[model samples]
Target: MDIKNKVALVTGGGTGIGRATSIALASRGAIVAVNYSRSKSEAEETVQWIRSEGGRAVAVQANVSLDREVRGMVATVVEQLGTVDLLVNNASITQHILLDDLEGATEEIWDELYGVNVKGMFFCARAVAPFMKSNKQGSIVNVGSIAGLTGAGSSLPYAVSKAAVHGLTKSLARALAPEISVSSVAPGAVATRWWEGREEQMNHLSPNLLLKRIAQPEDIAKMICAMLEQESMTGQILTVDSGQTL
Candidate 1:
């Protein structure tokens, strides 16, 4: 899948891995649709940076948690940027509740997290399916987490939601085979704003990792680019965790 002139949509493209992925795709000559929920400014910033680097990009606002918004977003991207040839489902949410604090895991918290982290991915993928299937070729990469594979993360619900994302990756791969290649990139602890006040946690985990440092967004972004370029790979969860899970 050559990225040159390809149209790619990245959810949560305003910040962190999504932001990096957007830039990476643009760098490869893909016209990126940067989707943001509340990080409009940041998403625009990413587009500006891409433009500065002589790449093409646009920031589209949409809350993946809502089906209508997802549909509208896809419609806008198709109308403006043409069909979505690549999709990176990176939008997600997490709570700080501990695994043992089941009481803190209220229904509201569960629903909110699931709404974005799991259901949102499904909606975005489903919305873009027709466009990709009609084109007879596409690539979808769900941004999963090591927590999904290992049952460890910021919170139990967050981990569970990521697990659901991993499941969706496989199911979508099977459902949209040959024409669309579906895969996932599960990253370990990354040094993004999401870890703003979790220095101690990062410090504690670094020495144990094979790389002895946390992953940067670009590290994961490079892996995602590689995944998008693979023509024969599908239904695979490529973990870019610096061997932390080992």
Candidate 2:
């Protein structure tokens, strides 16, 4: 849990919270494996930033939804940095979708959203468990959303997917306790490219947030660092909504 010189794999590291976390951990003296699906440039940019900051890091390409790619991702990470000390399941997709906007959603949406947010998360965790067990220690942090808790906002599939993540966190926590720890961070609203072109009026309502503004990626990233190293928390989600739900 010391994190210094430890190894961590962050999915969707190309941008947003994942990128922020990669930089944070690398800056803290940990070797980070940054994962991205198509945003190669962004992933490389994150790596460059980390290296420029005198931190060790490597950018990897992988589709989190595919078990094969997820397996390969972990393998390459371990090949480069040795055993992983932390795994952050941060990859997910959420497009503004009204149920009536189309045909009440479809298999495509379900597959894509659940594939990354739910299935891919568990796949990565499954791949990492053995390594953690072998090492006698590890931490898994799943990036979720406050929308799951509120049961609204994000696409129906997305909310359901995040709920599954929380469930996975609890079951895995209980199953891995005293060994590997599993926890979740359900952010309310962290500004990122994923939100582009989605909202119009709400875009100007940042000042109306409970904390009077939306969150920066670093806010959630640093919290993930703490959870992975804290040693006293697991199986729970720490939401960073600025009191939006309070």
Candidate 3:
């Protein structure tokens, strides 16, 4: 699957891995729709950057947790850039509750995390399926976390949500076979805004990895583009954690 001239939609395409991926896709000649829930300025900045680099892009707004909004967003992308050929389900959110603090993992916390991290991915995938099927080919890469595999993260619900995302990726792969490919990239401790206030912790954890450093957004972004461009792989979860899980 060569990415050239494909219409790519990247949810949360304002910061971190999402931003890197939008840029990467555009650099490869894909027409990009940069989706954001609230980070309007950042999304616009990303769009401007891509345009400045001689790439085509647009900043779109949608809260992916809402199925209606996801559908509307896909429609808007089609109206503006044609049917979506690639999707990067990169939008996600998390809370900082300690894993052992079951009380802190309240119903609202569970709902909020799952809404954005798990259901959001599904909604986006569902919204775009028809277009991909119409085009006869498509690719999707869900952004998962090593925490999904390890059951450890900022919060228990967040880890659980990511695990669900991995499951969704496989199911979508099986459900949308022959015409579309679905996969996941599970990254560990990426150097993104998610670690803003936890800089000291990130610094301390870096040397513990086999690669001696935590992953940068581009590292994960590169893997995502690779997953999108490959034709033979599906229902796979590729880890770009600098060997952290090892």
Comparing candidate 1 with candidate 3, which one achieves the higher TM-score?
A: 3
Error of 1 at 211 (Å): 1.5
CA RMSD per model (angstroms)? 0.8, 1.5, 0.5
Q: After TM-score superposition, what is the CA distance of residue 31 in candidate 2 from its true location, in Å?
A: 0.4
Q: Estimate each model's TM-score.
A: 0.98, 0.95, 0.99
For candidate 2, give the lDDT of residue 169.
87
Each model's C-alpha lDDT? 0.94, 0.87, 0.96
The window of 10 residues in a row where model 1 has the poorest summed lDDT is 194-203
Evaluated against the true structure, the overall lDDT of model 1 is 0.94
Task: Estimate, for each residue in 1-246, the C-alpha lDDT of model 1 and write its tens digit.
Answer: 998999999999979999999999998899999999999899999999999999999999999999999999999999999889999999998988889999999999999999999999999999999999999899999999999999988999999999999999999999999899999999999989988788888889889999898999999999999999899999999899989899
Clash count for candidate 1 is 0
The lDDT of model 2 is: 0.87
lDDT of 3 at 98: 92
Candidate 2 backbone clash number: 0
Clash-forming residue pairs, model 2 = none
Q: What is the per-residue lDDT of model 3 for residues 164-183, given as tens digits with 9 covering 90 to 100?
A: 99999999999999999999
Residue 21 error, candidate 2, Å: 0.5
